[model samples]
Target: MKTANKPRTSGSGTKRNGAAANGKKMPDVNGPAGDGKRPSLYANVIKQFDKAADMMRLDGNIRKILASTMNEIIVNFPVKMDDGRIEIFRGYRVQHNDVLGPFKGGLRYHPAVNIDEVRALATWMTWKSAIAEIPYGGAKGGIQIDPSRQKYSINELERITRRFTFALGNNIGPEYDIPAPDVNTNPQIMAWIMDTYLQMMPPHERQRCIHVVTGKPIKSGGSLGRDKATGQGVVYLIERWAEEQGFDLDGSTYIVQGFGNVGSWAARLMKPHGAKMVAVEDVAGALYNPEGIDPDDLIAYAKEHSDIFGYPDAKPIDHMAFMGTKADIFIPAALESQITALTAPMLKVRLVAEGANGPTDPDGDRILLERGIHLIPDILCNSGGVIVSYFEWLQNKRSEFWDLDEVDAKLKKKIVSAYERVQGVAHHYKTDWRNAAYIVALTRLENVYKERGIFP
Candidate 1:
């Protein structure tokens, strides 16, 4: 519990910009490269913050507060595997800020998990909630093992999750730090967190603590539209951007990277609106079918094969080809720094909708801007999940449940409002969308801090 504020370093011991500084090979983003020292995803986040902070002339005190995390919790928990081996897994929870309310973020399961990355993610969650006008902050936690390769049995995973939860202890609560699901994690995992946390609580408090974690199974006090919230948000922002830019979605083609939760859902939703997914690259492989790939078929293959490795309907494409493929729009839903200086130039789309957190580094972002590619920053682009998570939290607190239609409708309204606000700010400041987004969030936070003043 006391490990909540320990600053984490990337395993490689390289600075955020150090990887490139050391002449490391920059290639396609393989979902957060996990070699020795992983690049500072947290550094990328702070770079964005510093750029915006300087431009906005933010108060130095609040700027410092916003620059660092509020707490970072690291846990070394033991779990008995199905193989009868007791293994220890390292986990983390980085709470960025709670100036508005509770800290909310996702708990992921990935080999690339580290203090720097989670800290970056938690920081983004703070700005994201602020931009969405939600009364929540940011936090992120995950273990540093590849779930895909580990093949942990359900019982094994449940044990690992429960033990991790027990170790987290009172660091998480309904009105404190609430974590949802992230990469390789799902609603089922969220349920495990809820169940474990409740079991650890006082008998009288168990029933009222469902809000301790969100993105749970619908029957488990989860919101109806939570599963597709992030993807839906990505497309929502894209659709609005299209409307403003006079780009028609009906006949436009898009390329998506990381065909997992966000990419697959966005493709499926966009298909009904007549958009085409001409290319997709995932961990399994890359596929290109310029004639338009069927989302249903691809989704089915991914579900069965665990990756879209060899779908019969589409031809395999290399990562280079995947990035270089010409299309109307491109969505990077994979991991941070995917759109680096090398890959960014390969992108041939007029617009980029970032469905993943910090998909484009500042350098990649600069190139995209220079190339005249419109971008919807991750904070604004993939905020549908948190917005709906906020809804679920409110629902659980109020003992009210909403239907799918109601949930979707509210999500759309919130995203659209946020989109318009960011656009307005960008236009007024004559700045890029990424900077404008930060400006929007910072303004809200600044106003709050300015009005309330810092506590004694």
Candidate 2:
């Protein structure tokens, strides 16, 4: 548990902390550029939207509408700390667009989390839901405090979460902005949100409002396979891509950046296909093993040491070396803007399946395109988490639970169909996959407005 009030980020904006084997500084992949100005994630998202809109020659009015956020909710509430100190915490909920359906996204807990990042994520959620053919728009919110470095205990965190939920009040609901787990947040935190929201409602409403938030524990109305859905989705896409490109996963090597829930599950799920994860990198440091490290071993090490920076079983390597490793695939399951213009050229992978939202910046995407790297857009690649989240919401609303296999099977079908649709759209437009994905989403929204027309 983290101490409360004093906030810090989880290795975000981290500089070149590791030196290369030749003793030169490793370029900071996810931090401020040479001018010390951090790249704007929201701006990057807009750039993608603009490019797609241009390709489609979309109407100016619709383009402007899709390019902007629909609603922005910011709140500041005081939480009584364990030491009886009242510490004010800032929170934000950005509902990008709900034209398709109710707003849906995640609630992240990180000190580095801000309105812009949340807005970008919310916007991406809109595209993701559309690409996956899910009836959801987009919204993302989070409290601005690092879960790891915070001074709050479990009880204090619960109080703060409930108070935050209380502050949002009617802004969230079963058919409205549904929040799920994001970085530094998990099922337990979601359970707290669910319980708090339920307590505030009337008896009949309380029983029906559990869908106010998805990603809760199973007992709390969460779906069976929601935990591994995102990672499983990544592997499913990789399998289909491998088949399309005639690339064999057997005896093939890949590199995973970030060994959290997404990266770890990706490795474990891919091992059965004989795919080898040769390198792993996280905030602690990077690890390399050409012989292939066991996914279970790595998971156990991370559990025991709280990280995988210096696991004795693998050779520790630098950031540049990890990026430059010989691999068939590179999964950036870490943070936004991790692969910048500088580090983009160092990639040796044939495919980049974005496991994290906005992992590749606009500049990086341009470089990858010029280099002919098969870049799977984050919106489509990471739609599984939200898709499974939709399943959880559906289960709660219908008062029916799905089995693990049923959830996984449904997620795979939805994501694979999305991948095929994106490929066909890209081919038809003569554009890249990222732009194609945006077009798919924008076109859907455009049709909605065209038929319904803007209200007074």
* Top model number, TM-score: 2
Tens digits of per-residue lDDT, candidate 2, 1-456, equal 111212223443534222222222222333431234776778877887887888988888888788888877777666776766666666878888888999999898776677667778888889889889899999899987755534568888888899999988888888988999987788999999999899999988899999999999898788998888889999999999999999999999889998988999998888999988899999998999999988888999899999997788789999999988889999999888988898999999999999987899878998999999998888899788889999999999999988888898899899999999999999999989999998888888898988888887
Kindly report which residue stretches of model 1 are placed more than 4 angstroms away from their true locations once superposed: 7-41, 76-90, 110-112, 144-153, 304-306
- Compared with the true structure, the alpha-carbon lDDT of candidate 2 equals 0.85
RMSD each, Å: 7.1, 8.8
The worst-scoring run of ten residues by lDDT in candidate 1 lies at 19-28
* lDDT of residue 20 for candidate 1: 32
Displacement of the residue 110 alpha carbon in candidate 2, Å: 3.5
Quote each prediction's TM-score. 0.85, 0.87
Global lDDT of each candidate = 0.86, 0.85
Query: Model 2, poorest ten-residue lDDT window?
Result: 17-26
Q: Candidate 1 lDDT, tens digit per residue, 1-456? A: 554456544344323332234322322233442344665667767887898989888899889889889888887666766755566677889999998889999999876677777888889889999999999988889877666633677787788889999999999999999999878888898999999999998999998999999988989998998888999999988888888888889989999998878899998999988999999999977999989998888999899989998899889989999999999999899887899899999889999999997789878988998999899998899999899999999999999999999898899999999999999999998999999999999988888888889888
Residue pairs in clash, model 2: 2-150, 3-150, 3-151, 3-152, 4-150, 4-151, 4-152
